[model samples]
Target: MVDADQTFVIVGGGLAGAKAAETLRAEGFRGRVILISDERDHPYERPPLSKGYLLGAADRDSALVHEAAWYAAHDIELHLGQTVDALDTAGRTVRLGDDGTLVHYDKLLLATGAEPRRLDVPGTGLAGVHHLRRFAHAERLKGVLAALGRDNGHLLIAGAGWIGLEVAAAGRHYGAEVTVVEPAPTPLHGVLGPELGNVFAELHREHGVRFQFGAKLTEIVGQDGLVLAARTEDGEEHPAHAVLAAIGAAPRTALAEAAGLELAPREQGGGIAVDASLRTSDPHVFAAGDVAAFPHPLFGVRLRVEHWANALNGGPAAARAMLGQEVVHDRVPYFFSDQYDLGMEYSGWAPPGAYDQVVIRGDAGKREFIAFWMKDGRVLAGMNVNVWDVTPAIQDLIRGGATVDPDALSDPRVPLDALVP
Candidate 1:
């Protein structure tokens, strides 16, 4: 059933695409593997772009998925600085942007990934306004942070999402005055809800970061082609030397859309709609990472995850599925964030209105606690803040779908494993 004559062409050189290529070889496909990326740099992980790398605590090479020599050694055709301009689903071919070259493939994986959502406010093109989504963007922002720190300048950030907060911490680490503008009542309101979101707000406040909640940035005022201040809808103007638009990211679904693949609606976290095996509507085409919205059997929702863990695991899963292996990507959505002395890992999906109550264990004052979002006594999601080695147990409880007592869930003496059955 396996032959070297077959070729697999993976579009997008991010973690998902790169890992898929590696999995194909590891699975003993012995087929030609080609990976194409629009970015000039080799496939790299994105977490470091905002965390360690932004703070100058880690080097650029640490974020790379593989060494430069690894591709050639593994017989992977690495094509960097090239974009797939078109996808011809019927013909099983893709057109490269650099030239009118058409590459044919027996199977195709679209890991095109996502792009940073740009701010529609004026003065976005002004110098000192930045968005961190790529290695190059991080590289530029690193220098900007250093310069701002040296000058003791002010950094104004829009949106209090993960990127915004992480960069706020990084800016403070660089000794820059950091201020965040958010329309929500608290940080991460959409993800963690106001209850736990307040915890992050307090954490940042203690670290000398300013938060302007219940406000939206109306304009970015600039002078001499440089950011001078940011105006809020509340009629407040904050002096700013630099601005970061960390609102969020939008999936790159243009290629998949053009190919006539089924896509999930924008309201349901827009992405290429894929089955449990990560196969797109077109059987020969598959998708993974931030761009694929697959039905999560555990959560009972069509989920599209944009965190590092998704890309890290989604690629290999999609690869095995392409090889005709039974693959069900039902991994609980998971993500981690480190800001100042606080490190938190969140597992499962628990957006606001979805959970009845949030039960917390440990001390919120000490910033060490595990918060569980429950629906009718069933744990829908769990977030461990400054807690370690309990993710597996928390995931088990969620998968078990058993009613857990709030008192036991909140008791530190009770082992999380015991709550599963």
Candidate 2:
């Protein structure tokens, strides 16, 4: 077992890393904790980047995980703008950036997070093309959006996922003409299924966001080193003064692969493999957040989630495991998103083609409803959209393995708790 006073190193200074440091201290570990961040700034929240901050509803300070003084007061060492060159797992050391600073650790946690995937088609590297991942990226995009609104220019977004939809809302709020091009027929089809995805599509359509559904981007057209339009496979050019690529993200796993740690199989999305306790193949190493692929107790499969709740919960669980504590880390998966006037909270997992039935409570056509995905009368997943004070009831139904009646669930008069037990 590692000693209390030994050094604990956490790579990737994001939400997971920050919370791990906080958990180690709260668990009474009097060890030396060091957090290494690639970005110069400390860890901050990412959700606000697409919603509040991007719309100028919030500021940078509001997104911070903690102020600079908090790190100093907590006696945690913060290394900003530093990259880990290599992980010497056998030697229990990490080689730092170009200077080759070597740091020894009794325990190491890899929360390296994920990087935004770039559009690889032609004319992607031109100016006025942006991808939102970092605070700087959001700041730059906000400026471009302001300019777009002032000139009433067109903003072309290449993806219709959560980020893409949220940015489209922001662009529309700022008076810019917005167009979203999704390869899929509907937005968020992979997660929410077609019925619910259509709700979002209709919502955007009501707000004047044009859709180029079932289309592939052939190229991004630029002139004088700035984006001017995006051409789809149909050979039609859409005017775009600025472009935002929100395709998706890939986990940062170079260090884990180089260290020879096990990775999830190809079918599982290629994340770093870890047990229920978040312990990696190496006894002294552990992983959390977006990079971790752990067994899901409810779904009976390995799952990797990229969202705020997973990182917030997994970090503390991994810290406890590192301290020689027995941990299952079996909390139900949860995530929430805010797009326009719609606020959504989703709990539980229903992998693609896993659920056989969907039951909706309230009026889906009116954009107020709770959707339950079920298999053989048992709830597999539940989503509350534009509905308030119902998440707890939905989560209890999912976790308790309660067989719910479809008629009662659809009835607004039926209390959610009564449908369970």
Instruction: List the candidates' TM-scores in order.
Output: 0.99, 0.98
Model 2 lDDT on a 0 to 1 scale: 0.91
lDDT of 2 by residue, 1-421 (tens): 4566699999988899999999998898888999999999889878999999999999999989889799989999999999998999999999998589999999999999988889989999999889998999999999988889999999999999999999999998888999999899899877887767889999998999999999988899998999899999998899999999999888899999999999998588678999999999999999999999999887889998888898899999999998999999888888888888999999998855988999999999888999999998999899999898988888889888867889999999999988767
Query: Compared to the true structure, candidate 1 yields what TM-score?
Result: 0.99
Show where candidate 1 strays beyond 4 Å: none
Task: List lDDT for all candidates, in order.
Answer: 0.93, 0.91
Give the Cα-based TM-score of candidate 2 against the true structure: 0.98
Q: Tell me the deviation in Å of residue 193 in model 1.
A: 0.5
Shift in Å, residue 227, candidate 1? 0.6
Report residue 147 deviation for candidate 1 (angstroms): 1.1
Give per-residue CA lDDT, model 1, range 176-253, as digits (tens): 999999999999999999889989999999999999999988899998999999999989999999999999999999
| Cand. 1 Cα-lDDT | 0.93
Candidate 1: minimum summed lDDT over ten consecutive residues — where?
Answer: 1-10
What is candidate 1's CA lDDT for residue 391?
Answer: 96
